[model samples]
Target: MAEFYHSVTLIEEKCVGCTNCIKRCPTEAIRIRGGKAVIASERCIDCGECIRICPHHAKRARHTHLSRLSDFTYKIALPAPALYGQFNNLDDIDYVLNGLKQMGFDDVFEVSRAAELVSEATRKLMVSGKIKRPVISSACPAVVRLIRVRFPDLCDHVLPLKSPMETAAAMAKQEAAERTGLPPEQIGCFFLTPCPAKVTDIKMPLGIEKSQVDGAIAISEVFPELSQKMDHLETVETIANSGVIGVSWATSGGESAALLNEKYLAADGIENVIRVLEEIEDERIGELEFIELNACAGGCVGGVLCVENPYVAKARIQRLRKYLPVSQNHLMGGPIPELMGWEAGLEFSNALTLSADLKQAMQMMVDIDSMEEELPGLDCGACGAPTCRAFAEDVIRGGCEKTDCIFIYRKQMQKVADTISKLDGLKQFSKEEKKD
Candidate 1:
């Protein structure tokens, strides 16, 4: 089994165990045990859904702080395109890019530039028809992990291309090393991430042995300082190179739209993406050449780490898009052919299977079904499981017990009382007969 480390974690003291996270979790990966939320490492997709739903602010994304920049001789910031939408009424994208440089970064690399390269590579892959039908986008790490845990069969449909963040990190490091004559180890590439899933991806990337990104900084953490710097700027640098096609990748349908002349479907939000994946698994949408699924609503703009409201951020991205030139006129660059080398190593992590032995797993399934029949059938999270059936499964798997169900425990206590009453009645009747 592969080791798992998640970027989305719980701050135990703050959690009230209110079932907010467990109920909303797309995967029933959360359980309220000992009055604190416990996340099953294997089941978690690092989607940050819990982080969004928790009222106590207990759930948080683990990320590297700006202070870590001092460790490296040269620090480069790889800002996600979604970062541009964080500011209110921001006119030029360069302001955000320049702000990053002012915040101690030696250079700022736009992930959108890498997105353009990914778009081209994806277009070529789709045109070639070398892979399976309805190829899924690999841009969203959360969605990729969702498929790994819940929709393992659909793993083959996931595109093997490296995410824009990874590509940008790789390029940034190499370019920085070359320009500065600094050792690659001394030049650190830090991703400005809008989501915890990206942080997890940087730490443990799929389809590759390791990530090129040295660290990740949450967008929400940088938003306030960056905004102040942008406000104080006298003149913003004209260094924004990515065009509309690349920049638009910040929102939903943007990726599909960029892949011109293709029959593509885009789904945003974790629930909607799950529905689309289900349809694909059922072969209902086989004719579609590609499918883009974003875990966050309105795509990256809705990430838990993002500062602005998703709808407002989406509007900002649209307005920003209007100022950019067309893809052909402002082509940033093409795919780095070497980055595709990771494709060959791509394989399903198979995080979903319950047991390795077929016979044992079959028996466990039978036990789960039997146990579920005895449950209250409420699908309530009171028993620390999302559904009654899931609770039964957990019981059979030894993670929980049938007594954990309040109804079941009450019924057992009632039975005990009835048995005691019967014994008392029988003893009193026998004593009366003896006296007669």
Candidate 2:
């Protein structure tokens, strides 16, 4: 079995075994055990949903730090378009780009620039009659991983394109190598990430065999110093190259709008993304040309790793795009670059399946259904599992016992007490008869 890399981690001491994180997880990957929360590695998508829901801050994301920049001879920063929304009243994008340069980065590359190119490529691909209709956006790693585990039937419908971050990292490294004559390994391209899923993508990437990105630094980790530098910069270089189409990708609907097609739908937040995926799976929206889904609420700006309020950040992004052109990046005209397309197709993960063998899987399904029928079906999360059906599957898989459910435990205890009481009554009656 292949190993999985999850950016989300549990700080054992901070967890109080609360049900909040477990209930909110789109995938039933979390459970309470030994008075603490335990996450199933195979099922986790590193979506950061738990990190956002946990009250005690027990759930945290493992990300690269600024100190790691010292490892490279030349450091390049690939700022996500979401970064543009973090600052208050951020009128110019260069303030943020220049701020990154001031923070020891040798150069800066906007992920949005790559986003524009991706948008262009997507438009061209849509015009060609090659891909399946209602192409799902492959931009959000969390959403892609969610589809891999949960929506296997819709795999082929996903866009066969690399994410803008990957595109930016590859471009940045190539540019640095040409300019400074530095080897690819020495010139590190780090993404200033808004979400933990991107960090996981850098480790266990889909589509591509390996990620070009050297590391991923959380936006919250860099926001403080970057803000300080932005305030004190004596000179702001005209480093911003992306336009409205690229910058607008910071929020939901941005990508679909960039397609210049009205026959598209955009959904944000994991719950909504799931709903849209289900609709696609059911073939309910066949008329649509594209579907853009963002796992984070409001889009990338709403990532748990980001410090700004998502709504406010979205508003700021809208204001910042007023001075920019529609789009500055365009394809040079030809076949889509092989570098911008996925090398491998998304494969279904059996992490959530009962068994791989057809007959055994069928039998397991029947068993799970029987067990589920016996459960209370409240989905109260008392048994550590997110739902009654999930608890049943866990019991059948030997991860837990049927008695783990509070309702079942109480009923078993009641039966034991009744048996004991009956034995005592029979013992007293026999003793009375003997004395008589």
Candidate 3:
């Protein structure tokens, strides 16, 4: 089995074996077993859909706390554009940045500033015609990981660029080291993340051997301290640099719009993202030159770790963008920088494969098919697995028994009762004949 590490986990005590999570999961990475939810780490993208759907608040993202900043000699905060949306009636991004600095960060870096640079690089890459089209954005770690596992055909189409968060961390560390005369190791660049996917990305990166980010802290977790600081601030620092194009990335259609290309498609929400990928894989969406997909409904603003409602946050982001310039960062005229691109190429993961051995896999497929035929074809998720087909696979893999399905159990019980009735009738007829 391939090793799997994830930031999303189940609180077994709080889990009521509710089928809500399993059904909402795009990768079917969750299952209810032993009356608790279990995550298949290899399949999980840490999209936090389960975290969003769980009524009992059983699923949650494990992220670095503010205390972790004490470990570093010089701490830097790389706040996502989504963080700006969390503030109420916030007109300036500098307040959010200064608030983070007041809340213990030695310095603050805007991920949106890095996002603008990424956007410029993407436009240049698109012009070079060196990659496949409609090129998909690799900005969302959840979407990138989703493509790696579920949409292998679209692997080559993924833009070979590190996410803006990673880029911001790299830039923050470099600047901090130069200004403070500190070693790179001493400068901890932490992302104020809007999602668990970035937390997992920092822990187990996709296209890189290692992550540039030192830690991932949830925006929701930082909201209280930051809000308190913002409320008490006498003067807001002139910290905001990036503009409309960069900050717009907080909501849906932001990145694609930044490309300044009309022949592009953008989709938000996990289900819609899946549908778009399916169509692209089938070569149906041919007109567009670029594609941007966010796993959350309203982009990063919709992330589970965000405090404000997604729509409200999205509107705040729009209002926040109105006063900003078109864009603040731009790439120098030349080839793209190596540091900006992914160190490695995207590859398909065999985590979803039935078996390693071809013959064993073939036989397992046959067994799964046979078992599926016996199943009630319900994707109801009542059998602990996500779907009847998944339940069948569990039966074939010896993970569970056929009777685990309520429908199958009921059918067996009914058969046993019918057999007893027939036997009793036979006994009564024999007794009657003897008496005659």
lDDT of each: 0.87, 0.94, 0.92
- Model 3 stretches astray by more than 4 angstroms: 424-436
Residue pair clashes in candidate 1: none
Which runs in model 2 stand beyond 4 Å of their true positions?
Answer: none
Q: Please estimate how well model 3 matches the true structure, expressed as its whole-model Cα lDDT.
A: 0.92
lDDT of 2: 0.94
1 or 2: which has the higher TM-score? 2
Residue lDDT tens for model 2, 1-436: 3598889999999999988899888889999999899999999998899998898999999999999999999999999999999988888899999999999999999999999999999998999967888899999999999999999998888899999999999888999999999889999999999999999999999999999999999999999999999999999889889999999999999999999999999999999999999999999998999999999999999998899999999999999988788898989989999889999899989889888788998988899999999888899999999899999999988899899999999999999999999999999999999999
For candidate 3, write residues 1-436 as lDDT tens digits: 2377788998889999988999999998888898899998889999999998999999989999989999999999999999989987888888888888898899998999999999999999999998999999999999999999899889999999989999899888889888999999899999999999999889888888899899999998999888999989988779888999999999999999999899999899999999999999999999999999999999999998999999999999988888799999888888887789998889998778889899999999999999899888978888899999999998887888999999999999999999999999999999999999
Q: Using TM-score, give the best candidate's number.
A: 2
Question: Candidates 2 and 3: which is better by TM-score?
Answer: 2
TM-score, model 3 to reference: 0.96
Candidate 3: deviation at residue 152, Å? 1.2
TM-score of every model?
A: 0.96, 0.98, 0.96
Q: Which scores better on lDDT, 1 or 2? A: 2
Which numbered prediction scores highest in lDDT against the true structure? 2
